[model samples]
Target chain A: MLFRIIKRTDLTGTQAVMFRTAAVFLALLTSSVFIIILGNNPFEVYASMLEGSFGSVYGIKETIIKTIPLVITSLGIAVAFKMKFWNIGAEGQIFMGAFAASYFALNHADIPRPALLVIMAAAGFLVGGLWALIPAIFKAQFGTNETLFTLMMNYIALKWVTYLQYGPWKDPGANGFPKIANFHDNAILPKVFGVHIGWIIAIVLIVIMYVFIHHTKRGFEISVIGESENTARYAGMNVKKIIITSILISGGICGLTGMIQASAVNNTLAVEVTGGVGYMAIITTWLAQLSAPVILLVSFLFAVLVQGGAYIQTAFQIPQSVASIIQGMILFFVLGSEFFIQYKLILNKSILKKEAKGGI
Target chain B: MDFALLFAYAVHAGTPLLFATLGEMVTEKSGNLNLGVEGMMLMGAVMGFQVGIATSNPLLAVVGAAAAGALGGLIFAFLTVTLRANQVVSGLALTIFGTGFAGFFGQKLTGKIVPGPITTFFGEAKVPLLSDIPFVGKILFAQNLFVYFGYVAAIALGVYLFHTRKGLNLRAVGENPAAADASGINISLYKYTHILLGGALCGLGGAYLSLVYVPTWKENITAGRGWIAVALVIFTTWSPYRAIIGSYLFGCLDIIGFRIQDLKIKVSPYIIDMLPYIVTIVVLVFISMRKSKENAPPKGLGNPYFREDR
Candidate 1:
């Protein structure tokens, strides 16, 4: 018998929608099971999570606040992912970016706030881009594996930041905690209305990146590179240049994310300032399938889950680990659904034997 | 402060890394890099700690940890092997799962410390006349079981890969799976079994952390030793003996750093701490830049093998 690959478009339009709906619903169902396993009433826990995240006016604002950094970092990751460059060190890059930005903010306190902030942003972008560039350079020049390189770089960056936090950048008066002095008013990011300046930057970035990836010629080349580097090369697109350029851009945006998270939102840099958002951003980006605007939708829901998790913990005494578990579960189903999209489960030899034996 | 004491500490620290690197070496030789070793190590560390805590039997705890780590590897092999999932994603997911699971489980076992396995934690097992030797005996012969095992594994695995038939076949699978498949070797079986074995060894490495090195169970006792294991796999170019040398070097650097942290070394602790990762990165870059490096990764490394593709 000739083996045939299953066609993805074999299902009807409505069935396709139903499949997606059921998949997402299944994820929610599994998430509820986790809540139940943790010894909490699923409905009450979920309801309280919803209430805590969005029931009050301030809750929604906080959720929005959390979204800014995540959206920014994820959009950067999406750009790199689109080019098939796996930069898992974005967390460390963000740390480096914050460190670089904070250093400038500290040394250049004599400069006007607006100028200082711009310089800080530029420095962060440069540091982040350079951090990413190290791996990109390795990949382009020496064929070094970017994934491991980036991962290693993360530890290096983390240590670099920690060394400072524990030594030079340590809060001089606050005993021995790993934190830095707050930036001056000149370097502090200004808020617009109740929304964080980071959120405003995030919105502007989303629109620009969407246009860059979808409309521009360079963006078009990035998609080609991701599809097949050889094919892109055959088409005379400079694959190395594009990969390096895309990564630089991606890493730079992540730097801006670090700067904003430090200066605008938290007001000071801490070890957890990145808050593992950079890694979760990878999951969010993949869930959105790297669609620039879809990040907003996914991030919105992610923020809610995180917000809800805080509520669940406070209200039900559940471990904060529940949020991480829920994220993992969501990622599980989303990733698993790709199997259905790409391949059909056919009745193989044993299954065929079962069907033959079925008298009914 | 003496060479003998310093040498013993290096051996103790390097032993687990040696095992972990060797385990990763075997897997990479088969052309599948397992980044989940960190997660596996953490799981082993925690599980070993918990079992040792519950039963007070360190040997049984190592066994438990080895089994748990093998199970973790099986999960990785299943995902990348059976499902044809992206190996990197699956390995990463395994790390995530392993990390999260270990953290959750380890919460109960936190701050639980046990006595050091040996009388002085890392004393000796010296040969009769050798123990009296000035510098040589203390450094090489007088040490823990784990240290001896690490050397034995390095030598044994080195012999097996280069000098044995089964080892050749596994290397064959790594070098070119398609050709190996043509030669009627069971690529999938070799990969799955060795991967699990590698996982078990990695589990042992992790268990060593709790059982021997620190003699305490904590949330992240293994820390990032797993990543160092991955780096060592590459650093050694899959050489078993080189793994021992690399791990000891790393261990020595780390030990020395801690020993001299109080001395104003003109370098910040942060920059000093950054040395290992930076060194790893630089070494990898150097490895990549070498034009004549023939024993690079296996030819078919990381690419999924499907008979149908032929």
Candidate 2:
């Protein structure tokens, strides 16, 4: 059969949604092969996954905890992505933020609860912002590649934290086990509805980001820059300044996630505090298409996958990486499906007729 | 620390980076910027180790690793080249998928030793006449099969990229796909071939990590070497010959921290561990500052080409 790929100029909203849903279903079906390979029933595994994530109050709360960092970091990534800036260094920014917050939490345990928490948040914002600023400056001044620059920064930030954990910041009383001192009670974030206040913070940020992106002049400027830097320049926008400012805000929010995770989740700074959430957020943010409300929904679903994946590890003797495998497959299917949405394959009648006539 | 020993170990360490950088360089030359080298490497490492364990053949393990890596490249090519999806996101997806795929299957192979025959086959051996030479021979010629392959690959790629007509055509496609297409060069064919070939090389690099470096199966055996290889491509300005030097320098940086600790230096190893990444950033900044056209990336890089749009 002769077929030609044609671009679809008028895809509807419902069609796009349908395509995405099908992609998710296809991803699950594809991943079922692996479950079958591991000698388990795909349906049973999936049922347990759903049950583990939302079956009980504790499971739901843990899922929420997982969602918090992802939502906030995705929001931060969405802002930079809106400007076409590839800030893949959220992992580093998160680490720097956690490190900054830990500094205050460990050193100023005597400070009152509310003030200390406020101070830690501010410090995380500042440190994370500054850490990200280095690359933005280089990118603006020299037109350097931001992707590699930011990626390199992740390792630097990680190694710096590792240094502290084993060297200057090591808790001497812990019998030489390499670890930083835990945060004091005053530094920890309080709980609301069985989840840390980070959930409330996440919701507030979502509303603020939605308004900021859709309503504000700065947001419009960002979109313009994203579409075309030349267009933004022609419109009298200070491209360099806007890039720096947006990245600062972006990195600062990611840093705040570090503070929340450190204070509320880990109750202290640790190397695994981010738990690959920074990289995971990049995926979620892209999947969310840079929308704040959509980011919330996407991150929640991903958190369920993660929580359920964890649950299956214990319940079915499956490897923890099965979750990652499923996530990756889902991303692949969804990413591939975007093509089908934008274009379609149609049988070429003329070519088919020509071939038929030649055959005759 | 013995200088000769240090240099020798550096070459051994840099073999994987050399292979990966060369592969990525070729792929980029085809106008595709795939950021999933780390993921591809993991896939290669795990698969190569598994093959070695199952078959007990070093040659088959190497081939298997390259094939696995090419499979990853095939996926990226399909998404970016065929589907015309955003290259960056697709590459990231490839990375996530490859890493997860490797980890999922590699769970059983963890801690398992590479088969005796396979290890022995890949073990270091001295070239007869070359080993008789002085310090340089010991440092360069006395190495495993992977190191030798890296040398040959770098030299061959350098020649092919500069001295061959096909290489010129590839460069033309990267520089201006429309012009290349106008000249009757099959853009997709060139991209698919180079990308797959590049992936194969990346796989060999990963296999080197498992079959030679540690000689055991382990999850994430490549660590960040794949990323380092990506950076090295920039540091070399996409030159295969320059990749040799860049990879060795990075390899030295990778182990210098431990070397300093051996010298009883007060400097923390963690701080030293930061050097390669820091050096990469500094080199990138310098490269950008130069503003040399020769050092610039391919013009059509990271963009999906559609003939209809043109």
Considering every candidate listed, which one attains the maximal lDDT?
2
| Deviation (Å) of A185 in candidate 1 | 2.6
Docking class of 2: medium
Q: Is the docking of candidate 1 incorrect, acceptable, medium or high quality?
A: acceptable
- Model 2 chain B: weakest 10-residue lDDT segment is B85-94
- lDDT (CA) for every model shown? 0.79, 0.90
DockQ of candidates 1 onward, in order? 0.42, 0.71
lDDT of 2 by residue, A162-213 (tens): 9999899999988999988888899999999889999999999999999999
Residue B104's lDDT within candidate 1 is 63
DockQ of 1: 0.42
Clashing pairs in 1: A113-A186, A163-B270
Docking quality (DockQ) of candidate 2: 0.71
Candidate 1 lDDT by residue in tens digits, B1-310 = 5867887778778888888888888888887877789878877877877787777665778788888888878877876665565566566666766776676667666777764453243335676786678887778778866678778889999999999999999999988889998999998899999889888889889988877788766766887889888877777777897888888877776677767655656766567667777777777787778854564667677777767656
lDDT of 2 by residue, B249-293 (tens): 889888787787788878988998788788878888987899777
Each candidate's interface RMSD (Å, one decimal) is 2.3, 1.4
Interface RMSD of 1: 2.3
